[model samples]
Target chain A: MNLNNIYELRWKVLPPLAGVAMIGMAALALVTAPTEVIEGDVQRLLYVHLPSALASYFAFSVTAVCSILFLLKRDFKWDSAAQGAAVVGLIFTLLTLITGSLWGKPIWGVYWQWDPRITTTLILFLIFSAYLIARKSSSLDSDKSARFCSIYAIIGFLDIPLIHMSVRWWRTLHPQPIIAKLNPALPDEMLLVTLFSVLAVILVAAWFITLGVETELLSQRLLKLRAIAKINISEKS
Target chain B: MSEIGFLFAGFAVFWAGMFTYLVILQVKIRNLQSQIDLLENIIENHDEV
Candidate 1:
């Protein structure tokens, strides 16, 4: 197919497909899950909450990567991707904070704590928020702001691994891995649903990133055309 | 059952927020696209004149 068709696939079809997959995965999580002795009704919701945060973290990482590329290539595309990723990532991060707090309130007896996971996640959120705010303060030139954010993104992503691996290295009530470990915490049925949710969330995150990036590029183009049109009018006058 | 209601509430609120944001973006695209079209028309009319 032609390039436009490919663009359509990335921008149009992908997000819906991801959304369908996410819903399907959520359904599977609900259907297959046996009630946890510990968290009761809220336990099953882990499928959505954990995956949303993971996807958000993943999106932010993508932003960082694109930001680094922006610094190197000085290309607006990278900046666009980074910007879009930051916005979507922030949404997911906020979800993480909300859902994590909700889960924590019942499970941990506290809405929030200075735990490693929470602390690192908060750092990640601040990093992206700072990047976005930095964008606003910069000259409206997309590329320059991108270069600035890219540097921040690269620095910001360093905390992601720390956020992820902190629980393993230290003793935390946040619990250990159901996967990514020598021993899995979850039973196969629960694990199965979690896996499905991860996949679904990942695809959805990818689709979101693609759309956000494309939209940024389109906005830049539109802005340029407007500026040029204004210039032409001024010359005519 | 109360907990279940809250869970559902969370989902509803989250998804609604996401949908609203996307709708706003969609509106922006429409506005930009129309401007681009207008610009193109003006350029074309200028050529014909």
Candidate 2:
């Protein structure tokens, strides 16, 4: 197939396919996945919680890379994409924090804590949230705003590794990295379901990023067109 | 609340958040699409002159 047909297929088919896969995987995770010996059914929250966190990290990583590329090329496409990724990443990060808190209430007897992992992640969320706010500030010109946010995005990414390593680096109430460990503590079935959940979430997140980028690009084009139309009308007058 | 209750709450919040974001994005996309259509029409009529 030609490139146009491929783009059409991606635009038309991939989202619904990803949606179906996400629903199917979520159902499988809820109904069939085995419970952990200790945590019981409460452990099931990990399926979505951990995956959401991973997806947020994936989203922000895209934002960071796109921001760098935008700065290098000074292209609006990259700027729009970086903004889109930041928005999606923020959503995912909020979800992750919420789910983590939900999981904590039952297991830790509290909804919030100052643990290293959660604190670092909360900081990561705040940093990117500020980056998004910077994008919408009317004080700076578009180019300046983009450049400023790009630099902020690069700086914000430094927290990601710190968040990941918080449990290892300091004494924390949060658990160590299970999947990233040399030996994962989970059983085979639990690990399988976790992997499926992460895969489904990444697919859904990718679709959201695509939608966000397209919306931003279209909005930018419309803005430019309206400006041109206004200029044309003034000239005619 | 029972452990099962917490599980239900977690999943509920997850799907609710996802759907809410999706709805907001859809609304923004719809608005942009209409604006784009209107701008294109204006430009086309201008070109016709």
At residue A91, candidate 1 shows an lDDT of 83
DockQ of each model vs. true complex: 0.45, 0.78
Clashing pairs in 1: none
Candidate 1 — number of clashing residue pairs?
0
How well is each residue in A1-237 modelled by candidate 1, as lDDT tens digits? 899678677756787788899679867866767777656766766777878888987898788888788788887878888888888898888877777777666666667877667777887888789888998677546565667677878877876686667753664555643322212388788888888888887887787777677677777787777787777777667
Chain A accuracy of model 1 expressed as TM-score? 0.84
Q: Which stretches of candidate 1 lie over 4 Å from their true place?
A: A1-8, A159-184, B47-49
Each model's lDDT comes to 0.74, 0.84
How far out, in Å, is residue A49 in model 2?
0.4
- DockQ agreement of candidate 2 with the native complex: 0.78
Q: Highest TM-score among the candidates is held by which one? A: 2
Interface RMSD of each: 1.9, 1.0
Model 2 Cα shift for residue A31 (angstroms): 0.9
Q: For residues B1-49, what per-residue lDDT tens digits would candidate 2 score against the true structure?
A: 9999999998999899889988999999999899888888987788788
Give TM per candidate. 0.84, 0.89
